[model samples]
Target: MPRKFYDGPQRDKPRENCAIFGVACDDIGYSVSKLLYSGLIALQHRGQEATGISLLETGGNIYTYKRKGLVSKVLNNRVLSKLWGNVGIGHNRYATTGAKEYSSSYYLQPFHFKNNEIEFSLAFNGTIPNYAELMKKLEDMGRVFVTNTDTEVIAQLIASLSIGTEDWPEILRLTSKFLDGSYAIIILTSEGDIYAMRDPLGFKPLCIGELKTGKRNLYFVSSESCGIDAVDGKFLRDVKPGEIIHISHQKDIHSEMVLRTNKTAICQFEYIYFARPDSIIDGVSVVEARMRLGMYLAKKDPILKNSEITDNAIVVPVPDSGRSVAVGYAKEAKLPYIEGLMKNRYIWRTFIMPGQNRRKAAVKEKLNPIKSVIEGKDIILLDDSIVRGTTMRQIVQLLKERGGAKRVHLRISCPPIISPCYMGIDFPTKSELIAAKFYNKYGDSYIEEIRKHIGADSLLYQTKEDLSRAITKSENELCRACLTGIYPLKSVEKIREIEDSIAKSRT
Candidate 1:
C-alpha cells in the first residue's frame, strides 16, 4: 500500500471561483495594463489556473487578453507592452464548480456588453447559486448566450433591464432584484465611470484604496487588500457587504442605494484559511486572527495534560500560514520556536498543479529540509490546517531523517475540517476529506487518530473556542458550517437531490 495520508489536499477539492482586481487612475497617468498587472500579481494567491487583464482607454474603447496560466507566465513585459490604456480590470482564476472555460477569451472579464450602443466592462468574483435558473429565464427573453459564467448572465440581465433606463443607478437597481448568491464585482463604463458592489450576504471580500501618482487620485477595488498594496495604494476601507460603490474623476466615489441587502453571511474561511495574513477584511486583520489561534492552541497542551517536561519539545511551524501561529504558541508555551522546513518558493503550489502525480510531486518541489535548523530537536510542526496529509508526511520524514529529530509533533492552527464547505472554499465532496475518512476508520473524536494515521508522534489542533476567539467576530457573522456542519443558508435541497442520484451510482 502507498500509505497515502501524507497527501496534499487535491485541487480536486471544490473551490471558490476567481479573484478580481480593477483600477481607475484619472490623474497622474499610467498604462492600464501596468496597473492591472500589479493588482493581479498581489492577488495571484487567490487563483493560479488562469490570468487576464482588460483595459479601457479614457476615450471609452476596450481591449483584453487572458488565458489559463500564472499571471507572470501569461503576461510578461512584452505582453504588458502591448496592453495600453488608462483604466482596467484583471482576474486570476481557479475553477470551482465550472471548468477553466471561465477564463477563455469570451468568458474573460471585464465582460463587455452593449445594448442599443451603451457599453460597459464588468468583472466579477464569487458564484451565483441561482445561475442555471436565471440563465434559462434570460434565454427565454430572446437573449443569446456565449460563454458560461455568471458574469455574462449578469451582464445580459442588466442589459435586458437597462434597455429603458440606461443610467447607472437604475441599471444597478434592477440588478439587485435579480441576483442571488455571493458576488463582489466591478463595472467600468465607456464614459469613464466605474462601479463596484458586494453581495448582500458578503460571501466574498472587496476593498478600496487611494493611489498617489499623476496628481491623480485613482481608486482601486479588489478581492483583497494585498492587491491594493501591490500598486502602492493606501488601504481605505472594506467595501461593505451589500453596498454599491461608484468611482470616477467627475464625482465623489461612494456607495449608492441601488444595491443594499439586509443581514450578511461573510465566508468563514477568509479568517480560517484563505485571505493573506497581511490583508484586512471587514476591519479585521487576517494575520492577527491566525496568531490568536496559535496562542489558543498552546493552552490545550492536550497531550501534556498527562505528562510533565513538555518544555523540552520544540515548536516548529509548517511554514507560511502556520508561521504566525507557531510564534504565538512558542511564546505562550515558553518553548523554543524553530523553523524546521523551508518552502521552495519556486513551486507555485501542490494542489493547483493539475494531476495526482503533479500535485504530489509539487510537495517535494515546494519544501526543503532545514536539517541544521531542526536536527536533534523534539520538533513540533504547526500548520494553518491539514486538508490532506501528503506534505505533512514528507515533512515529518525530513525532520526525522535529515534534521535528525527524535520526535516530530504536529500542531494544527485551525479545527479539523470534517464537512464540505459550500460558501466559498472548494472542499469538493465529504469523501475526499482525510479528517472525514479518519473519523470513519477509527471512530474516534480525539485528534490522536489523525496522528496515528499519518504516523506522527502526536497532534494538537485548535479548538472551536480558539478558532472563534481568533476570528473575533460574533458567532452569527461567519459561515462556520464547514467546521460545525451547520449551513447558514438553507440546505441544498436541489443539489442534494441531484448528488444523491450520483451517490447511488457508486453503491
Candidate 2:
C-alpha cells in the first residue's frame, strides 16, 4: 500500500492551479527578474505555496531559482540581482492532491529540462487528467521519471516531439493532441524564444502585452491581464484558444491558430471566485460579471419582495470575496449595504494550523462582526460559494451569537458545486463536497438540507442560466462541470466514472 497524506481542514472553496508569467526583452542589458517578480506578485492570489523563475542568459544558458515561499520572500532584490537575463518565465504553485507529496523544490516550476539534445524552461497552469496514460507511453519509450507531476510529463512529451523539428508551434500542436484537460503553458528555450499556448478549450486564462521604454520594446505573456498591468505593460488582448504565440527578442509577435473548436469552455469560476476582480479574462471583466451575478440574484429574490423582510434588512458581505456581489445586491434590492464585518488581514492560511478547535478560533480571529450595524436587523449575508459547509455554518453562528442579528439570509453568487473538478481547481473526490453529499442523499431537497445544516433562515443560489447570463457568455462557452457534473474532456469523464464506482463500493 502507498502512503497517503492529508492537509489540515478542507479549504472553504476550490483552489486555483498556478500562476504563470513570461517576459521577452529586446536588449540583453535589461534584467527581467524584477519585472517577473512584480507580475507574479499581482497573481499571488492564484497560488502562494511556492515561487520560481527560469531566465535565459546571454550565452543561451537557462538559469533557474525556485523555493517554497511567497513571491516576495523567494525573489527579493538580493536574489533577483543574481538572475540576470533578457528573457525569462516565472511560476507560483498552488498545491493539489496529486502534488501534495512533491511540494519540494524539485517539483516546483519553472521546471527546467536540460539534456544533450535540448534545453528549455516551462511554466504551466492547469491539470492533465490523462497524464498517467502519457507517462506510461513515455516510460515504455525509455524515459525515466523523477516526480509524479503532469508538468514533467508535458516537458518530456515536448522534448520527445522536438527530435523531429524545432518549430515550437508545430511541436505544441502535436502536444495538444495528446493532452486532455485545461492548460495555459509558456516555454523559454535556449534558442532565445518564448512560446505561449492555451489549451483548445481555453479552460484557463492567458494574455499578452507589450511595453516600450527608451526605444526598447518588451513583450509579456501572463495568466491574467492584471499581471500585465502590474508591469506597466499595455494589455493587447487575450491569447486565443488553441493559439500558439511565439515571442522573440528580434521579432514583434507571431501567432498561429493551431487548433479550433466551435465552442470554448472557459472556466466559469474565474469570474465567480478565482480571478482578481480587476482582471479581464477572455475579454470579459471579472468585477462586472460578479456585479451582474448579484443583480440577477436580487431580481429574483422573493424575500426582497416581502415588506416585512425588507423593512430592517441590511446587506452584509462575508468579507472581501463577497464585497462586489453585496454591492450589486444592495443596489438592486433597494437595501442599505453596510460593512458589518471587520477583517484581520494578518490572519490567513488558518487551515494549516493543526486541531479543529484552533481552526474554529482562527475564523473569528480572521473576521469580527460590527455589532452596532448588524444587531437587531435582518442580515442578508452574501458569499461566493459553499464548499464543505463547515466555515459557512461557523460564520452564521457567529453573526447570530456575537452580532445579535434577528435573522440571516444567505445568498450565493455561484451555483452549488456538486462534482469534483479535474481541470485545475482542487476538489478531487465527491465524498469531500457538501453539496455532492446532500444531492446524493436528498436529490432536489439538497438546497433546503444545506440551509438547515448551516442554520440560515433562507439560502438562495445563483442558477446556472443566470450565472452564464451574468458572465455574458453562452452556456456552451463556459465550463460548469463542477456544478453540472458533466466534464468537457473525455479523459476527465472516465476518471469521474472510476471514482464513482469506488465511492459506490464503499457504500
- lDDT winner: 2
1-507 per-residue lDDT for model 1 (tens digits): 000111234553334556898877765256767778888988887877778877776566877688778899989999999887777788877654344444356755557786665787788877665676788999999989887667788888878877766578667767866776667888877777778888777889999887766566678888999998998889999988878888775564677753544556787678767788899988889988877888888888765553443645778887676798888888888788877778877665455675656755676677766777666667777887776665576667667876787787788877778777655456646676678778867777637777876668888877777677788876666666667766655434455567669988889
Model 1 worst lDDT run, 10 consecutive residues: 1-10
> What tens digits encode model 2's per-residue C-alpha lDDT throughout 175-198?
999999799999999988999999
The whole-model C-alpha lDDT of candidate 1 against the native structure comes to 0.73
lDDT for each candidate structure = 0.73, 0.89
The local lDDT score (0 to 100) that residue 8 gets in candidate 2 is 29
Per-candidate clashes, comma-separated: 12, 0
Collision pairs in model 2: none
